[model samples]
Target: METNNVLKICPPEDSMKDCKTDIKCPIVNCDKVVFSSGSLRMHLTRSHGISESESDDALKRRIKVDPKVYKEYHCPRNDCLYNINSERHFTNMAGLKQHFLKVHAEKKFKCSKCDYGFGMEKDRKRHESHCGMKFTCTSCQCTYVSVEALRTHCNRTQHQIPEMYTK
Candidate 1:
């Protein structure tokens, strides 16, 4: 990324012009006529084609990302890499039943940020959210990953507060 790799990312200028080669955006659905930040308004107007009174959230939800969502399972059962797609298609019911029994039952916790360890990812998240232990933030006073993560955050960010006056 340091050196120019031929392509450069930018917004489109007009409908007649082609996108600059430097831009790496290959998301074909892009409604941009020309690559430029200013084309954002044009994109929303053309792509959504919504009424003026439409709420911003409603118009935005019209586009579905399920088509773009990453796959959840790969079914490592045999040589059958039969891609269990996200859109609800089944390759082998037996394979699916076996997989659920094997994988999901093995562990319970998961990291929200990354695919880290957990007895149960849900349990880990639950424990973090309401463990009842007080956590004083170092970066701010509120945001924290876990009580331990909060401690780490404070330690890393070096948060300090003034001492109250005493008699």
Candidate 2:
């Protein structure tokens, strides 16, 4: 008969003599040592092909639902209203750092036609629909989706109107 073996992300506190970091691989006989909990999670996923949810569950079980261990980092922005009742909390330092960089850092993507800027490409694309270069039909009260579409419509219909192309 086969017996189920439970996996844990870290050993109990009583077992820690020299392991100050406390983040150790749960795999049997694996001596891999990492500095942070995040690194250990990454090691589990990359090296052992364990999914994030699996590692997270194991970590939670090992840590015994300790809020101090999980919610160590909190967002410092006072004006930012993310989870305002409880405040935005992160599981690790890296997650908090990344949240700060993404939410408060300078915008990376900018629209050339307008002064609008965004942090992500998808936001820029959404803005482009309204602010980016568009083709309008001068002949009638109609607008084409793109320049190529306008050109095709104009070529096919041969509608002669003043100022055929406009930005």
Candidate 3:
């Protein structure tokens, strides 16, 4: 007859403590430290507004696991509004890498009159306003820094666009 393992008595210990490991916040400049990966995930998702998959990837990068464990790629930018505003989940490393390259890595807005580029559209517009290039609407006598603004003014006033600006 075999003895059941349940019959053997074990020492009392904190099960939660046994499962806990020191994990730090992966976001740059964040000084928070949590005990378990699950707790860290919760912190990242709720406190930092990071997506679940992104937090999972962050956990994977910080923790050691089996070689056969699946890998997940996450956006490293903590201030990325795209990820925070919506639950953007990447299915593969390529998609995440592409998002970083296209969205975070490079400037998305450029000044039309200058070589300067900006990561935010508002920053680009502010810079363009002071870039020394001005477009004036002849009909309304209003000045704008960008041709797009002038075009908008023309549309609002029902003014015809100059032939030179038609293109």
- Considering every candidate listed, which one attains the maximal lDDT? 3
lDDT of 1 by residue, 37-58 (tens): 2234334544656334344334
What order do candidates take by lDDT, descending? 3, 2, 1
Whole-model Cα lDDT of every candidate shown, in order: 0.40, 0.56, 0.59
Question: Which ten-residue region of model 3 has the weakest summed lDDT?
Answer: 5-14
Q: Best TM-score goes to which candidate? A: 3
TM-score of each: 0.20, 0.30, 0.33
Q: Which is the better candidate, 1 or 3, if ranked by lDDT? A: 3
Ranking by TM-score: 3, 2, 1
lDDT per residue for candidate 2 within 66-161, as digits (tens), equals 333333355555565532234445655555544554576556678767867765455566767767556677787467656667777877889653
User: lDDT: which is higher, 2 or 3?
Assistant: 3
Show model 1 residue runs off by greater than 4 Å.
1-105, 108-139, 161-167
Q: Candidate 2 or 3, higher TM-score?
A: 3
Clashing pairs in 2: none
1-167 in candidate 3: lDDT tens per residue?
A: 23231122111223311333346899999988764566777678667777567546555456543434433334555565434233544644344544554465557578897878764455677888769777788787788877788888899889987666788
